[model samples]
Target: MGRLATLAALHGVATVHSPGPDVAVPVPDETVVAVLAALGVDASTDEAVQDALTRAESAAASRLLPPTVVVWTTPDPGTSGAVLPPALPRALADLPPGTGLRVETERGDTVEWPSLDAPPTDAAAPGPVSAAPEGRSWPDLPLGVHRLAAVAADGRTAGAVLVVAPREVPQPPPRTHGFLVQLYSLLSTRSWGMGDLGDLAELATWSGRELGAGFVQINPLHAAVPGDPTDPSPYRPSSRRFPDPVHLRVEAVPEYAYVTGQGIALLDGLLERAAGLRAAVLDKGALIDRDAVWQLKREALEIVREVPLGPGRRAAYHHFLAEQGQALEDHATWCALAEVHGSEWRAWPSGLRDPRSAETGRARHELIDRVDFHSWLAWLTDEQLAAAGRAARDAGMAVGIVHDLAVGVHPDGADAWAQRDAFAEGMSVGAPPDAFNANGQDWGLPPWRPDVLAASGFAPYRGLLRGLLTHAGALRIDHVMGLFRLWWVPAGADPTRGTYVRYDAEAMLAVLVLEAYRAGAVVIGEDLGTVEPGVREELHRRGVLGTSVLWFERDWEGTGRPLAPESWREDCVATATTHDLPSTAARLTGEHVELRHRLGLLGRPLAEEQREESAEVADWLGTLTRLGLLPADGGDEEEQIRAVYRFLLRTPARMVGVWLPDAVGDRRPQNLPGTWDQYPNWRLPVADAEGRPMTLEELAASPRLHGLMSVLRPSVVN
Candidate 1:
């Protein structure tokens, strides 16, 4: 290998990739240097490259252990049911034969494995890792993150984070179907202009019990960046770790009932305004105004804060305060500071930018009341989420509320500010150039540094998982491929100048599996679009279900025809549409093309785009007609939409998701990719085929939705 190639390989940065079959793209030298720089390696100058290369070459020899190690115990084939021992990974095994090994387990128990017998650990992250011992090498260890230290015969010492995880994640209970709704767009009469937690709970209860649905998956409700006009996209969240307070239903808070005297008059006025906001959207045909909704809710929340908490509520609040610990404090502090300084932490006074600096400490204390208010908002939202889950359970749903986890956090969000050390400074996660877009794409969210995560024992990742799974029946990871690797683009550079940086997929999956196992929640990975070879298989092997959109599930290796229902993978959340794509109704009628054309997002002539889109839709419809899933005589838009979902039910997929809007014959895509101000992306309320907004109650009573649900599995009633 070349010097730069060797350095890049050692750092888990890809030097070459095949964006297409038999075509290799060698990463640019500048890209490699920039990526290495982001990882804290100085390789700008030739002399610096040589020096860095020399250090990297000797890193394995000088290192006693990697920052982290994994002990994935498998069942012994020879012994039938016995589990194989957790061997010392290749790195530890390759140590001097007489080295002593000590482990401190998560439970605080200590174990001293005989140094002579333990298998080696991952080989110091040198060139590549080898397979672990599957035979009778060591004793079976508990599944948890532990601490391991090694001392060699010559007094050399090293320590590593030891992670023991289940071989797979929790599996789904059985075949079931659910609805996938973008939370903001599913407004109800009671909603304050847009969908709130109250609407979510009502939808869950009605669908789960009345429709016999097993789950209801919603888009990310992660804390959004506070701005005069906030970014409407939930995927670009400020903090994926905390739920956004704007989703909270003000009237549902227990304390909302206790306001007395003049407080009642003020709250009544706020409620009247909130009703006007809701009416403007549902009756006046105005777009959902998230900022206005939040303003009203925020004002009412400030009023509600005056009521003193009872003893039980106070204790519960204290428990939540203590459980969240410093993470909550940092997030609340950042929010408090944002109110004073501005939303961008980077532009704040230098010392204040450092979350742990003395200046930030004093500021936190001075603004303790505001900090407490933000923290309280988080607590209230969390409580409502838990209540929603309870409502689902009460409705006899098997998989209650399935939640989505966004790929990463916004750079200026609380997570990036609070956990600054764990993210790359000048790098953003994106995709490399491909057939879809020659320019490639840059998602302005910062990725977590694999090196920092390993050294910190993946504390931040674990905390994130725990928070999300606290009330989720299942967790759908958006852009699941990010668990394995991410395309990192340097600031001010085209995405074509980016390269894929590998993460420790094994460790990442292990942590994920461990957390899901603890929560007893199934995981569904969004593995749509171009996937790297073997990634889907690996995710499946770990019991992480893949996403299969009907439009894209063709027999690519053979005839390139729509895949037969029987041939679809059983472990997936099968669906006809997603929030990013055209709704089934739109796809069937070709309105999606017209919508794109209207926004000037079409790359070709209008007629050409329409022709291609219509052909694709006709191809799917023809397949459906051939298989007798759809009427041989052309059916209407509603029948075609039903047939699309009916085809999903034919597949052995464990869970099928029905986009909520499709149930009511909605043609507008919740989000149209590749457009900004030109389109009303993520701002429209769920409406009917006629383009009229529908309240949650109206949606529930829609005969069209009932007719469509009848086409689903027999579990759901007509």
Candidate 2:
């Protein structure tokens, strides 16, 4: 066990702190062994541990450079006119004397590093520690993903990925306020029962141009795993790489314009059904049935597909196919196969289990039409996403269409099947036991294999980011700590038994910065809960903004009171509440406590929970009053909500996000974290104060919403 721990630590496979910093928590031996096994290391016994450790040490010693190297130029604004020194990697010190080094930049440029003095050629001797060539300085290279190659004097060749990134991501142009929404919960008159990319475009344009807002941040649009009863939570998606076709605005498809006669009659029937689906949620108080909506859209899409694409559109689609390449094919093929067999690939016939098997290939070939249909769906979805971005930009948004990225992929989803070798087998991404939940959490998503990711030079990660960034002016990464480390739970194990598995944070951040730079998008990390000590600092250093919710901003280490607005960090998106938490009205009215009690989700006595929640609200209200942002006599519900925005506006935070529901006093949380079937997790439409479902048009006209928006307006705030 001790040997395993030692080797685990050596391989960066274990962390002392999973979510806390006060006590040193060692990962259980069982967890360490399991995680090590996932990394392709055998550590089940003493003999195996010793053998693995020896091989690991030998491999580390023999390697002149790591599989990937990240170089970030520290931007010093003070040195305005002076040229700064190039950042150098310390691994250069480990290179053998007289070893030749070559750097191939992404732009087809190359730089050479001449060899230093030769040393002894003793095979058993340790790696050379000679200094770098004294007179030579690193070449000023363009920021991008590059390649590095090293040739030893003995003719042994080694290669690594060289990533040159900006020290920080570009920040938003100015302090601006925006709307934050669970996109699925936003229903419009034109939507097919639920919010689609069309709704996003309309909301972005109206909010940005008409309301003078700066951006519209929405939930993850990632693809969902298909099932009889599909999981509706955006956070647990099938693939983080592709947007869901269900969100496609069917009417916006170019082919929809050409549908005629019987096809048009068929579409009318589907549209009527869609109207009922939308009415069921808005008027009848029925849950949003994604499956029902998709059934209708699927039929309508088939008719639309029959209309041939014009030459221009055909060329554009062919270009998209060429660009997306094999990733699209694999994803489309998986979807096609899922329709025939089942969504869960694990339960499929043994011959079809492997994505690359002959049987799977044959199935893909036989179902080529279905595969092409799915592929077309993805391309249409992509076009709508791009159109949404264009709408936001045209509406004068500073940061338009800020998209959220899910943390991981579902175990039986497309990415898991296509990139089978890149995910850890039989392990789920989760959280360690923390103060909030003694049992912790298991997200049921497979984490990427760090070793495999490094071996592949993080191509999957880079590709996913590229896809999302294509139509995003800013990207929010959910549970951003996963980039540094994630809790790996053995399938079906208690979350307490899970342990932290470290990732190559340098490489991860470098890839993120490089992509964000190329896309000209801002990056925001959801760095809210149980963050490690230095993670926030590291993110800030790289120009990534952190999330800061008002309720969680109290000084825990000090006065246990509301933190002063002036003390809040500037590199954050400050908000009064998030989608997962209670709305401002619910908190102020103590309605959240009642709701939790009604749902039997209260962790303690209802009275005690109410008292604690009430006291917290009082503390913040007092702070707001002292700041002269609220009336001393205690304001009305709408006034208090506006006061909360005023408090956030006073902060130095670069961006302020107004939860769309909060504007209209929606009290229910969009998500109740611990319970699945116990609550309607992601089925509710955006509602008004009285829990009345609202359409985009109605929300725009709502007096309460407009009242709240007035408080956040730059003219009023300034």
Candidate 3:
């Protein structure tokens, strides 16, 4: 390895291998240097590399502690397996004997330990090097993000974040089945052309109470960047912290009821348009047009805003403003400014580019009304989110409303603009060229700069998680491997030229565990593909459930055959399909291959793709038959679907997810990963096998949906 690579690795800016152990793919020197540059380290030359390496080593040696320390909570006092306090690392081992230690906990209480020389009983060094007396331990700390500071015997002082996390996050209540839907695609009769939070609440309540579902996991509902033709994909959102009010049910707002005069007339006109838009999708079989829906909702919301908030509602809005604080202000300011300038902050005039500039401050002052309007929208969005949660819980769901968190935010989105300092400039998060995407993918989303995140004690990450977990019974982290490392593709470069940028996994997981612990929520990590060797084990240790898809549960190293139900991992939310892949029905009938061919998305020859896809399906069918999951003569597609779910139930997985569309034999995928414009990605409504849109009422009345639900329910199935 070159000195530049050495420097990058030392600074946690490089990876030694691809995600899998089979490939020891070294990051190129140029990619390492570019990634280092993004981290503010100029390692462009040999001299620069040497200088950076020396500085990095010197800095590490000089620090009394790392920027952050994560300590696992001790579960029981009498247990031999109780977690030990974090040991002082080699960097701080040379501190003088009488170095004093103190901790200020999250609950505003202070605790002091005597000195490094006088450690408590039962202290054991976590590593080979022992500093204090053997079997010594630090003072007990309550679970939280505490402040830790050490005053050396020579009077030198240094501080670090002290994170106390539970050994593992709380497990799921039981092995229960739930519906999984794309919130926007699951439109109801009352929706304003597109599904909203009100529809989400209704889905949760009806599915949970009537169907006995334990949870409803939905796609990320993060804010979208407004535009003439807005991007409909929920995965690439403008802000992950605050939800989009475009998903809000306008009539649910209390002020909506009090609108008068011209406002009522304006809303009436918008409603008429909304009715047409809704009809276009439901009756005419047209795809859901998000921008059209948003346009009508925006006009209607303007009229609703004119109706002044009642005293109680006004107080609640102010409370939300105070709670969200500066983050919300920055987001609101960006939204307001986007109305005058554009959504892309970089294209704004130099004076307005910097959010904290004096000119920007002046502009914000002038646009205070618009800013307040955006803030009010955020408050309204939050209210509906809380209502959905309440609806889920009241409907008797265990882990109600499992919200999905996208890997990163859009390049020109509110989060990138608001938290500019935290994002690496001129770089995007993506994947290395793997078996799936030969050319690899550049997601075009900026990654959080690890150094900057550490400098801020991971406040940005903490806040993001906290916001998502606030209204979620569980949070599903998409591409959860990102918590350890991210592929950083330099600007204007192909994804193949990107290198892995390592993050402090310990600290990242610690923050996640801490937040989820506080929220009393379960966490599911989407560790589905190309994960490094230890990533899944670490996530499992921390009580984050893994995502296991039925199609991919094969023993690759051994038989390459479909894994038996008993062989499947227990710590997962097992499902037959995901948004990115084909629906179960499509997979069974090989319609996914036909769909790809129709869209010109097939990478190989049509016959080859069809044959290979057919063989894969047949293999799974053979397994089902051998295991007696299928009837002797082999059942129809719907029966096979039920058998596939039965195989899932036979596994020890804690949760089973039923793709809502699968209940009615929806064959089309909500998203096709490879093609953007080639397919109507993210625009399809929940439809049956023949691609007919199905409303909630229709779905409720469908015997097909009820039969599928019965398969999940043991009592009805028996």
Best-performing candidate as measured by lDDT: 1
Candidate scoring better on lDDT of 2 and 3: 2
lDDT of 3 by residue, 1-718 (tens): 6677678778787646564556677766777788888888988888888988999988877777788887776444443123544564343455567778877767666766557656432233121223333334455556677788888877778888877777777778768789899998988898888889999999999988888999999999999988778899898999999999889999899889889888888888888889898889998989899988888887888888888788988898999999999999989999999999989889999998888899989998999999999999999999999999999999999999999999999989899988899999999999988888778789999999988888787889999999999999999999999999998899998988888888989989988987897788999999977897799999999999999999999999899999989998889999999999999999999988999898888888999998998899889988888988899777999989988998999899999999999999999899998888888899988999888999988987888888878888855432
Candidate 3 residue pairs in clash (backbone atoms < 3 Å): 122-135, 123-135, 123-136
Number of backbone-clashing residue pairs for each candidate, in the order shown: 8, 0, 3
After superposition, candidate 3 runs with Cα above 4 Å error: 19-22, 75-96, 118-137, 715-718
Q: Which pairs in model 1 have colliding backbones?
A: 89-120, 89-121, 90-120, 90-121, 90-122, 91-121, 92-121, 93-120
TM-score of model 2 relative to the true fold? 0.95
- Candidate 2 lDDT score relative to the true structure: 0.86
lDDT of each: 0.87, 0.86, 0.86
lDDT of 2 by residue, 606-701 (tens): 989988888888899999999999999988989999999999999999999999999888988999887789889899999988899999999988
Name the lDDT value of residue 326 in candidate 3: 91
Query: After best superposition, candidate 2 residue 662: deviation in angstroms?
Result: 0.8
Measured against the true structure, the TM-scores of the candidates, in listed sequence, are: 0.95, 0.95, 0.95
Ranking by lDDT: 1, 2, 3
After aligning candidate 2 to the native by TM-score, how far in Å is the CA of 196 from where it should be?
A: 0.8
